[model samples]
Target: MDQTTTTTAKKVLCIEDEHFIGELYARALTKGGYEVKVVIDGSEGLKEARTNQYDIILLDLMVPNVTGMEILKQLRDPSQPALKAKIIITTNLEQKEETRTAIEQQADGYLIKAEVTPKQLVGILDTLN
Candidate 1:
């Protein structure tokens, strides 16, 4: 008898308004065996995220139409259904200490966009699983 093992790829949603950054993460994550979806607008991203279908959500603090902070607040609100996806705050914006602490309290992980490379992002996701 023969046996085989298979693992389902983790689905990732990247909410980034920067085209270059979004594509870069998407390419690297896809290469790392993750099913990656990139949304350029915060409103659209939030809509997709509300579906609760992704395993991870990489949220940029400065997206258009709606801010990532707003999305985070809505998703983490007790009024909504519990979210199964790990929300990682990815941004280059420098926040006040109080704001940062608030964000950190709700997010699974926080990464500065300027400091992390695409490869490093993939590595971080690997550890999350």
Candidate 2:
């Protein structure tokens, strides 16, 4: 008789363009018991998401090459929700339409970057469930 055990870390994928902000988040989340993968470019970010499984996705609403909304749509597509992961969109822009649009696309949560700190951001992940 053998007892088997496996350890899996919570994985968080961060799709953000700002170098300082992205690095700030990766470091903060990494300290909060998550395995963090940060991608700065929109196209590369999409590729990374497709190739990985993440418990949560922290995305910037404004990214080049592939807008965050496009990424959200791709993730939540009914044809392939098998790969769908919990998404949280963060942005400096605070338009009601953007919030409504993000909710329509299935973002688990939305945060205004100007109003959040790295610590608060990490704390927010605890509410994802």
Candidate 3:
């Protein structure tokens, strides 16, 4: 395979509250060749989600100022272009109800923080339609 082939990199936006997790995820996505941006709070995350174009979104369930559910709710509005992006939930919370909520909000996938690594997440993105 020619390493120089032109493959348009995908854009990814990660919404996370924890400092370490944000850096970890961003670094991983960057290494995976995606243009990745990290926002620490749901409000700021929501703002970025509204103002930008992304191929996918990684949303943490719990955050300050706003929760992931709130962000998902706002993004689901038909007027937002980002709503078309595949939304992936990343959270330590693995409750069935939370997963159901994420699904209802149109999430493409859900990842339990403790069970997933950056490499694995990138692999998931590779399998997307």
Candidate 4:
């Protein structure tokens, strides 16, 4: 008799323009038993997020082509199909008080890039559920 248990790894999409930060997140999340896909631009990130295939999405505010703020708005729009993935804002840039409040209200989580370590990021993901 053989007893084997197979658990699917949680899928994580990391949208960060900083190559180093993206890589760091990919490595940490992978090590934490998640399948991670890192995209360096907001255009690609928005495209991927629209698929609604991931369980978690780590988004950065500033990126090429499109901004993360726009992506979040689109995802949260009632006109579009709802997304199952939780969107977490990961950014170093500071926004206005009102803007920050608005974003925090929409996002599942928010973290400062300079304050959070890659390992801490993985831990944060674990707590999201």
Candidate 5:
């Protein structure tokens, strides 16, 4: 008799407002064997983040309804259940001080959207573990 084994794909949630960017990441991640969910609205993304279980979260800073920073703040709050997933900030903004603050606030990693391609993002995720 022959038996087959299957491995579960890692889950990733991408919170991005730009439709093209979000789709690009989603397509790449899906191709890389990850189950990817893209949320275009920050508020909706935050709700999904709190409710769902994911291995990693790709968050964009300047999103509508709720900013990624606010979502990170809430996720890091001691009062909330510890967010078990790694949170990586994906943004085009290049403010040095803000980057420092995000790192200080417990962001697992940060990437500039303009500087990273989807394949590179996958490489980054691979190094996380």
Candidate 6:
């Protein structure tokens, strides 16, 4: 029998306000062979997103200090032009208008948090790769 090993782990940034949700996602993603970073504060998450390159970012819309829309705007801004991380909005917000706006802002994907389990989320990320 032969075994294959992966040399690199996919990096994931989870910007979620709920501590339990964050931990759940981090644990699930880690189990799925990803390097996960969870930030409960939107401002700090935004700062980190702007500075580091990740394979994917799981963002929540209603977070403390800064809105996820604002973070998306900054990340998609043509002025910066260097941030290329794929951003996926994982929020409980269920508004068609907001979804449209997120799509317009170049969000890679959107998911209703209430509808997705951590394992399902990992499956989605796998498709992206």
lDDT of 6 by residue, 7-104 (tens): 89889999999999999999999999999999989899999997888989998988999988888888888888667689998888775786576665
The parts of candidate 4 lying over 4 Å away from their true place are none
| Candidate 3 per-residue lDDT over residues 40-116, each given as its tens digit | 98899998888888889999989889988778778886675546688988888756786586566577788888898
Task: Predict model 4's lDDT versus the native.
Answer: 0.91
Clashes of each: 0, 0, 0, 0, 0, 0
For every model shown, what is its TM-score relative to the native structure? 0.96, 0.86, 0.86, 0.94, 0.92, 0.90
Candidate 6 overall lDDT versus native: 0.88
User: On residues 1-129, what C-alpha lDDT tens digit does candidate 4 reach at each position?
Assistant: 899899899999999999999999999999999999999988889998887499999989898899999988888898888889999999998889987988977889889999999999898899877
Q: Can you give the lDDT of residue 102 in candidate 5? A: 62
**Residue ranges of candidate 3 with Cα displaced over 4 Å:** 1-5, 79-82, 96-105
lDDT of 5 by residue, 1-129 (tens): 889889899999999999999999999889988999999998999999989999999999889999878888887888988988999999888757965776666898888899999998888888887
* Model 1's TM-score against the true structure: 0.96
Q: List RMSD in Å for every model shown.
A: 1.0, 2.8, 2.8, 1.2, 1.5, 2.2
Q: Rank the models by lDDT, top first.
A: 1, 4, 5, 6, 3, 2
Worst 10 residues of 5 by lDDT: 95-104
| lDDT of each candidate versus the true structure | 0.94, 0.84, 0.85, 0.91, 0.89, 0.88
For candidate 1, write residues 3-122 as lDDT tens digits: 888989999999999999999999999999999999999999999998759999999999999999999999899888889999999999899998898898888999998899999999
Q: Against the true structure, whose TM-score is highest?
A: 1
Off by over 4 Å in 1: none
Q: How many pairs of residues in model 6 come into backbone collision?
A: 0
Superposition TM-score, candidate 5 onto the true structure: 0.92
| Top model number, lDDT | 1
**In model 1, what is the error at residue 6, expressed in angstroms?**
2.2
Model 4, residue 106: what's the lDDT? Answer: 86
